[model samples]
Target: MHPENGLPENSPTTRVFVALAPPDPAKDELARALGPAYAAYPRMRWNRIEDWHLTLAFLGEQPVAAVDLLRAPLAELAASRAPLSFALTGGGHFDERVLWSGIEGDLEALQLLAEEVRALVREAGIAFPERRLRPHLTLARTRRDDPASVVEVAASLSGFAGTAWRAARLHLVASNFGRGPGPIRYRDVASWAFRDPAAGGHSR
Candidate 1:
């Protein structure tokens, strides 16, 4: 059994999630909109641009061996799905603790994709909580004492809208957070491109 959660302790484990990330240009557009927030809420914990992603399935703390079981199935799923078109638009907050940017366009397709992803994880024998899909990219978090900061910042982003972009890849990522005192870091364990027939069955 694992020392932390007692699932299985044969090998080390990492917290994992499957997600779709906005392209660099799209992320840059959102970053520009956040400039004022950055200055006003300097104490808030802002997520790095590179770490911003729309999580499809959160498979928290899985043994490395269990995580490896997901690779092939996820790749095949990605190969069958078409790219999704979406844009960053507006913003919101969750209980004034978290700040997030909302997503717009092709929402039906996005929901379908998320459902399929969660199904795939289940088929791989990975157990995770099932939560309703709320399409948003987490931007930052405010301290418990500074509740108003997120509310104000979210209001500032009310009218912000970014250019639409194709989400072409599905990323299986791992984060190192609780294991150490250093800043949390996210890295891809594997990624698969959406199959585009016009692009010769490859991602552009």
Candidate 2:
């Protein structure tokens, strides 16, 4: 609400985050595996497969102008780093509510990348709460016994181990969350390919 006008203020801001998306094949495999769960747990708010991503830094809501300041720096950072290899292996639930699939492969490298990403966010003068990074793809959420059965669902995928794929890009995304919406949706603001030494550039 605009206090001065006593009306809604339409400030241009974006709910942005930095993340890495899984390749289509990897996501498809996991989707197939969850076919049964999709039927059995219809009540749980399952995330659209296209929306799955491993978030590194969530900058909450920032003025569009401020977010623009990050573009070139992130691109340069992407150019200096190489794509990472990862696999979707196993599953777990957060606090018996939110369901997620765990990550596998060089976690140390992933952690380092996440750290560097956060550092870059800080350097951008964006303020976000600091928290330890736990890499996972958010699969679904249950609001309490909206299905207390989430535990069973998580345990069911405990041994899921998908084949490995490279994390090829650095994605800056804007989300339509808490915007008087149905399911939240996301759109890519910009993405930069990781440096490929042989090509001397990224595919983006």
Candidate 3:
């Protein structure tokens, strides 16, 4: 089915995911930490700072109609949850192919949130493979010919620790990766701010 405007089955589908993005100041701090790696490993495919996010659930490709069904339920979920506090710390590589920054602080809360998001998608009848949650922010990727670069860069970021920030919103994002030429681009399809119970479920 078409995933764009939910016109019909002939319309294009979008790759979607649920996530939390760091604020500009938090992202800037991480950018500053990566300055040296950016210069040293110019060949690495670095993700754009604006695209940096901590994924809560990857919904894969879904029809626009199906994705639309998630909005109301997700909004209700967000309204029941409070903001989470977290910080970006250290770095790691996945099989020396993808470089990522680790997450710290309030991990238990983060896991619970991820679980709830996945449950909501499933309850909506969306079928996606279940995978364990490993919280990390993808930073860059290394080419097959130069596998060592990611390892070196990851080591350089061992002591890097970003400032704490409250994750206030849950975002439904659409990506066009591997669907066309040029770099992958991401845009928000929907978002909801966390509601504070003490404040009468009002989003701050």
Candidate 4:
């Protein structure tokens, strides 16, 4: 169990897996491409485009203190792995509620990154949620009446194709702040390079 954040040993804090995010232009392009669809479903709580990221894994809540122990190995993993190049293609919905854009290019690299992050988390004795990594950028969330709107949005962006972007670093972020009654904010507590310069290959 990790240490808790001054919460009388019972407050819930979410633990998640995060990776380096795409550049601003890439994210903005996706947002612009998705704007019309979002206009159609005003009720949906669309995630701000600035929050788009490529998640490598999702580690459930843990004692907050455990992060220090986990950071070293995670940094090493990042230093050993090479960067990845990818593009955005198409749009879809999750359980008819959450809307997202699909990712293309270098998917194999993404899978490898997920596996490495999972192994590192396990090595630190942290309990992680079991779920396959589905790499996609979340765009918006829907309400009960959102199914039809979601379908329409999905059909409209069926042919989206964005320019490719390269990923160079891995970031450990905090999501507790900027979530409500204000703009959402994500803080990167730590980050490391995608690969070791000497080896000319991604870390194993």
| Candidate 4 residue lDDT tens string, 127-160 | 8787898988877666676577776787788999
Q: Report lDDT per candidate.
A: 0.87, 0.84, 0.87, 0.73
Model 3: runs farther than 4 Å from truth? 1-10, 197-204
lDDT of 2 by residue, 153-194 (tens): 888898789999999999988887798636677777889998
Clashes of 1: 0
Which residue pairs clash in candidate 2?
Answer: none
- Ordered from best to worst TM-score, the candidate numbers read 3, 1, 2, 4
Q: How are the candidates ranked when ordered by lDDT, highest leading?
A: 1, 3, 2, 4
lDDT of 3 at 119: 94
Backbone clash count for every predicted candidate, in the order shown? 0, 0, 1, 9
Q: List the residue pairs that clash in candidate 4.
A: 2-63, 3-63, 3-64, 3-65, 80-202, 80-203, 81-194, 81-203, 82-202
Model 2 — which ten-residue stretch has the worst lDDT?
1-10
Query: For candidate 1, lDDT tens digit of each residue in 48-164?
Result: 999999989888888788887888999998998888999999999999999999999889988888898999899988898888889999998888899999999999999999999
Model 4 lDDT, full chain set: 0.73
Instruction: Say which prediction, candidate 3 or candidate 4, comes out ahead on TM-score.
Output: 3
The candidate that wins on TM-score is: 3
Q: What's the residue-level lDDT of 142 in candidate 4?
A: 68
Backbone clashes counted, model 4 = 9
In candidate 4, position 136 carries an lDDT of: 88
